[model samples]
Target: MEKKELVMNCTLALHGCRTSYDRSDLDSWYLLGTYEYDGSKLYLNTLDDKICYCDRYDATPLKSWDSLSAMLTSEIERIFGLFDADGHCIDEDVPTTPVVI
Candidate 1:
């Protein structure tokens, strides 16, 4: 995915907040989850009815959203596989799949 594609994916994922007066409101927009790249690291925040998952990665600075999205997607898949229906980790195994944004 390119920058546009990553942006579009994030936008679509945040559709529920499109009508909100403050699109930048983390609480409203991140009801599901959010990802951020801070030059040297990637951060993930996943919120659900039963739990919230927060993680960070000390990764190389991504030059494009393509890389950023790839990392985010991969982390998300890992999170999903690690957790059970109740948001609890099922096992110690971590996911290695590269999910597209």
Candidate 2:
């Protein structure tokens, strides 16, 4: 949980949205945090876990929806290493030994 929180916080600090997954019994959902942006300057909650945000040009107001689809797609790309195909780790044969200090 701590690790997850840290990741969320860091992401929010960087991108204004720290998108993350919320695993529950029935289903999973995307978690989004609050933010305030001034054109390009963005100010968001460092404790939130969201990745995407949108502001419309309507007079009523804007809504906040969990970007589950986008977050999942991004996660899939990360897990499969498709984003950086050449950066995958390689497992090579190596000798191991034990010594007494």
Candidate 3:
């Protein structure tokens, strides 16, 4: 018989609901929950199958958990080329257009 080994990664929480990540292949995981603070939202994912979801808008609200993590992932994808509420750009900073007086 052969045995398989499991690998686990950890993420650290940042100020407010944000987090500091040290992930290499971020595409492998799925979102599990979210926390709202100020005007920003933080989505959390787990390496394990267990989830800690808490919200009324969940698709399977009463089911406690579901595989619909792809939904949040998709939302993150949709905003890939935009700026946050703050003035930070999605990509690296670029020179702004100057105004002519």
**Could you say which candidate leads in TM-score?**
1
Which pairs clash in the backbone of model 3? Answer: none
Candidate 2 ranges with C-alpha deviation above 4 Å:
13-32, 35-52, 55-67, 72-101
User: What would the per-residue lDDT of candidate 3 be over residues 19-59, giving only the tens digit for each residue?
Assistant: 55655545433444333311222233345433333332443
lDDT per residue for candidate 2 within 1-101, as digits (tens), equals 45434333323223323344333332222223322222211122223433333332221222222444654455334333321234322222311111112
Task: Show pairs that collide, candidate 1.
Answer: none
Candidate rank order under TM-score? 1, 3, 2
The C-alpha lDDT values of all candidates are 0.36, 0.30, 0.31
Error of 1 at 88 (Å): 0.8
Among all windows of ten consecutive residues in candidate 2, which has the lowest summed lDDT?
A: 92-101
Residue 53 Cα positional deviation in candidate 1, in Å, after optimal superposition: 17
Evaluate candidate 3 by giving its C-alpha RMSD to the native, one decimal: 16.9
RMSD to the true structure for each prediction, in A, is: 13.3, 17.3, 16.9
Candidate number of the best lDDT: 1
lDDT of 2 at 80: 36
> Taking the tens digit of each residue's C-alpha lDDT, what string does model 1 give over 9-101?
432232132365443555521333334321122222322212222333432222223333664564555545544565544554532222233
Model 3 local distance difference test score:
0.31
User: Is 2 or 3 the stronger prediction by lDDT?
Assistant: 3
Better of 1 and 3 by lDDT: 1
Q: Which stretches of candidate 1 lie over 4 Å from their true place?
A: 1-66, 92-101
